[model samples]
Target: MVDPAPAQTKLANEQVELNIPIQPLGAAISRYGNATGRDVLYDANLASGRLSSEVRGVFAPDEALNKLLVGTGLKAELITGKTFVLVPVPASQQARQTSSPEHLRYYGLIQAGITDALCDAQGAHPGRYRFTAKLWIAPDGAVVRSRRIGSTGTPRSDHEIDAALRRVQLNKAPPPGFQQPVIILIVPQGPGVTRGCDRP
Candidate 1:
């Protein structure tokens, strides 16, 4: 859980000009750090394959950061006036650490596999709904099983999401000590959501 009071107090009155484009979450965060002169620290896996909203106008750092993370199911916690870190929303937080290079690589592969599966079918395109999924992957990169924790507002959509996950197969095996039951949040497209998934 994050306490927004400190960030609110520190950045309530400071505004800066920003022109970050809708891009990968990690790059967008780097741009935010540069534009706001603040250090944003986070596990690289948290941003892997995630898209950020564009921040194109003058706004407080906190507000801009919030805008930048619109659909990614993440929030920033201020560590200091000059620093912040990204964390999963309270309900989605999992007991996993993804700091090692091998772990990060595995995470990226898993996410890419899931994204491809979700985007391949119109009924299950991730940009159309919101839900949380728990995945159990095999050593050879196949998604052995999956369980979704929320609905996509309809039984058909829920079935579609499950079907998509069933088709996921990563390019490599997970690293040692990588936790099981990976938790992933899927959300609809909005202000900062990544575009181009609809492209042919």
Candidate 2:
């Protein structure tokens, strides 16, 4: 079994500017990035103010984005005229790591296969879905398990993404010397769209 998703690293600042796609209406619509690209987040689609396409990785549903802006009076609507664009959210503390050489060895072994599964899974999705797949590795880098730390896509797609991740395998020994667990956060090749999918 995989370890649970790592908690967001305690942030030093309350709000950070995520590389989100905003419409000319000044409404954020999507987010991207994950471990596959070493969780590199990017900004896309914007001209002066109005948005160019439907945001792809805001994580939350359109209604949620609307709710978030309710107090602010800004509307969150999907743009139908343009193609959808994927963007990555801001990087968080939990997304990064500082490991020793031994840990690096295990990280390499586990991440190689894990990422491969991600590539295969992302390719299957119609929308470019990107998000962080957080993994727990031993001090030597052996993978314990993985979870979507962040995401952008449909709810069913998130489930599909989770299913795809479950197919990954880590059948190797961890690096020498370390016995503690290690964590690896992965970002898929596509954009993530899994925000505000909360339960009451």
Cα error, candidate 2, residue 39 (Å): 42
- Best model number under lDDT: 1
Q: After superposition, how far is residue 56 of candidate 2 from its true place, in Å?
A: 48
Top TM-score model:
1
Among all windows of 10 consecutive residues in model 2, the one with the lowest summed lDDT is 32-41
- lDDT of each structure? 0.72, 0.38
What's the TM-score of each model vs. the native? 0.49, 0.35
Worst 10 residues of 1 by lDDT: 1-10
**Residues 1-200 of candidate 1: C-alpha lDDT, one tens digit per residue:** 22122222334468988898767778888777767766778888887856666579999888889878764657889887667889876542423445567777777677677778888866787777788888765545566678888898899888988888888877576664465557777767789976326544
True-vs-predicted CA distance for residue 58, candidate 2, Å: 52
